[model samples]
Target: MMTYTREKNTQLLISLLKQHGVRYVVASPGNTNTAFIGSIQGDQYFTIFSAVDERSAAYMACGIAAETGETVVISCTGATASRNYLPGMTEAYYRKLPVIAVTSSQPIANIGHLSAQLLDRTVIPKDVAKLSVNLPIVKDNDDVWECEIKINQAILESCRHGGGPVHINLPTTFTKPFDVNKIQHARLINRVTIDDQFPLLEDKKVAIFIGSHKKMSKDVESLIDRFCEENNSVVFCDHTSAYKGKYRVHYSLVSGQEYNSIITERPDILIHFGEVTGDYYNLKIAAKEQVWRVSDDGEIRDSFRKLRYVFEMSLNSFFLNYVGHGTEINISYYETCKAKLDQVRNNIPEIPFSNIWAASQVSSKLPDHSVIHFGILNSLRSWNFFDIPDTVTSDSNVGGFGIDGNMSSLIGASLTNPEKLYFLVNGDLAFFYDLNVLGNRHVGANIRILLVNNGKGTEFRQYNHHANYFGEDTDKYIAAAGHFGNKSKSLVKCFVENLGFEYICASDKQEFLFQIDRFVTKNVQDRPMVFEIFTNSNDESCALEKMLSIDIDKKIVRKNKVKSVVGTSVISSVKKILGS
Candidate 1:
């Protein structure tokens, strides 16, 4: 039995959410959202988090959804508050996560003229949302049932349509205090199953590309791994896999020249999941083949220019039902490729004391079943290069989102799963971008942070623009006046300490190694810790560029040698010698 009243519409909203299995809400509170916040203040069924930055709040919801495979809601006030969600919403749209944005808008009458904290909110996120509904203001008790129905429909649509984000706009006057005792047996909808199947490949080469499957069940993950092993298929995975380390998944196969070569020699069938593949061009080539995409949500469209089949089912279920445990001729090919991959892995030069090395070292030490929330920009590349531990799950808004929501997302992740060892790896610039996140220090003791401070925009030196525009003077570029160039080491320590964090900074390799080892091994009081590693901006940039150049040269020489032996050496030999 359920109860409802006119004045407690906000409470009804919370009740309806619990009924529909919403476990988390990332919200930016304001006067407009007072009623909603009051209703859910002490509720046990949901965890409501407050983020100072609404954009980060939205991404935090997306991050939660990415980990839970459930719709996470984000709430903000009208006007610019709602607008701040664009970046995260765009990411959710592309990544196909179930994020619901619950926004409060101005009254309908004052929408057009200049009203405080008001703007054109009607069609702001039309392109991104799977469904956008403007809820009618609740003035009487009779509107409760209608509002509940619409909310249910929107949630159902978000989940059923393959897990994309949705939006629900509630005007400020919509909340009328309501009684929880009056509503009885409101409504419940049964799950609807969809038919999903794929034809077996009898004599075709097959490859599997797995993206960030952050929320996939362990059983499903094992099923996929077992199927791939039995079939002698090539497997590629990103940082999100919990079993990535065990299956010998190719972490580098998604990008670079190697990816291009793999795509050029197209396989007969390709099975893809998670968001975009690392390399766009390789994906383009793979899409030309008979691609079979398996996803629980039906949101995956054949936009990569390839599609033979779309299986709308859980990846684990599909693999268990259709794939057989068989090893055939492809075993030899798989072994040969594995050998090459091994060579590449073994030949990777050891990184010195720099951001890249630090990132790699931290990734190696990451605890099993831990969540790693990374900042955007350069830190992303470092993690992408290193072999992330299977137990260390990760989430980030890699696409351009204005705010560095990495820390906020970590907060939400920790709140959702307090038992797990959660860590956030961020650059100094990113840390300052959302430093206010620490203002709301609600996260428990398990949360940790690894802050990389290179003094300035260390990543910019790798780009040609810096080289061409600023010549070889990297420090000059670093010292340039702007947002990114600011170095606030003292400020960082002060802020973290103020937030009750056990803050420590290491300026060299030995100190960093010592601090990290001590931090991970020692049993300290349960509190969040921040280890800041100070590194040289120029050295970090140089290391990556040098590695890339060496790789390019090796490929050129190898290709030219092949051409020379085959009497096709005219242009190839010249290009190789000239390093073109």
Candidate 2:
């Protein structure tokens, strides 16, 4: 029987308590305390010990803390029952034992009135407890956020930063039924804005999703890598996410839109941080999941609809505080998602010859430790299907995803490290849009550019583009074809050669393969390299359309065989009956 109630304030307290893994909740039963006691009695996550005497419950919590070297909770009703906790709280304060006394009280306005069972718990003896927090009745979102902060304050004071006893005065009503099955979500506000110190989190199902990000610092990358390893967590990444860490789920999640497999792998606590994602491609997996958004600004950017916690610190600091303390997950969530991806990969047929197919073939050719930047739309979306070496970090301008800055971004990344090779796999339109960067003096011999020229915005030839409905006219005005007067080699070759680059152009797969090996080699021809591979626009769109249905058709074919067998069995049975 699921017996947790719908009281907002109590829900916030319990949600946070579960998050911190507060196991034992000692309850002293009374009329005012029924709201908390009745709700918790049905939940198996908490171990409830009944001690009718309020004073006895407090002393028992102290004894439990002393013996176990763990924080223990004491729950009681309002009135003189709170006074009974003074002696035990003082002992816990002096002994530095971590004991939390949560006393349920009537509303503050009801205290001075002639209302029964009301007491002003606002002012408790300072020395009796390390700290006392009166949690308000959470009616609005603001109240809800405040309620969680106070609960966290009590939680932190009780067990962390030199352990000691703390008091929480919970104000709640007594009418709601104890019928809620799952614990409600609560906002866990961390006050450590600038400090590296983080609070320990106790949730088991932790997920870190990285959207578009800058190249992470080595220290931050190392910390993220270690945190994922220790917690057995997964980092969901795409081509634009730009995070290359261990335990990376480096699959194009946009490809999984049809399967809804992403939704199946939802986490109990999702930690998402990075810039905006290009794959709004139904990331609705996090729709109702607990998310803690980590950012420097610490502002409320609730991308995930079910955001409960906002840690206003660096991703590293937020990760450091939550990694080691409470992750004891037995199942591999990473393996679960990986297995689904592997199954889909096994069904993936020989990709049709197009920009994607060509990119896949040469993706493995990029040198180790090289930085690869992708253009927006077609280029970023296609290369995402292939795997890159972890030593290589890749990114795209998904923040304001536009074709105009792809080459410029590549040049900027190249300037970061002159000795290490920097690379770009871009579409013709994007390259031409940012063509001025090619002549820039900052272009170094270590730079490699793979311009996948589909003649125009071939993406506009596909289903999603508005121009697809405009007929052949899309070839001119929409697809923006016939650029450089459709003479691809003459214009691009002359331009690159004039810009002091080793220009290599391929019109066919065989031609591309013959030169791809040499093109990717260290400092090809000692100048900045441009390998422009030309393809038909239709081929580019068809290849993408083919990939989307690759697994869908395979699954349908398997099920159709079962249907055929069932039909044959029925026909044979009918023929036998007719003969009889």
TM-score of each: 0.57, 0.60
Model 2: how far is 520 from its true place, Å? 0.9
Displacement of residue 114 (Cα, Å) in model 1 is 32
Where does model 2 exceed 4 Å of error? 1-204, 253-260, 280-284, 326-331, 553-580
Q: Poorest 10 consecutive residues of model 1 by lDDT?
A: 183-192
lDDT of each residue in 1-580, candidate 2, tens digit only: 6767678888888888888778787888787778788887877888889897877888898888899887888898877898998888888988888998988888887878978878888898887888888888877887877776678778867865568999988877886767787766876544345454544445566778778887688778777776776776777777677676667775563344342345557777777888788655425557344777788875555676556656677877776675565545443777887886777666676655677887778788778887888887777777777788777778888877777888888888788778888889888888888899888998888888888877778888975567799867899787898885473577888888998888888888789889988777854347888888888877776777666655554555665576677886776787799995
Total backbone collisions, model 1: 19
CA deviation > 4 Å runs, candidate 1: 1-197, 241-248, 253-266, 276-288, 325-334, 350-352, 398-403, 464-485, 522-524, 549-580
Tens-digit lDDT string for candidate 1 (1-580): 3334334445456666777888788879786765566556655667888899997898888888888898898888866898889999888888888888888777657887878787776776565788887766666645665565557666766786577888887766644553455333334322323453346666666777665555767677677666656665666555543345334444452243321244433567777777643323234336334667777774434434345455667676677774564644234435655665565556667665676777767777777777777776567656666676665677766444433678887887788876777788787777777777777858677778888877666666654335435744654655332354455567778877888888888887789877887555423346788888877666676656543432344666686677767766577677799999
Q: lDDT for model 1, on a 0 to 1 scale? A: 0.66
- List lDDT for all candidates, in order: 0.66, 0.76
Each candidate's clash count: 19, 0
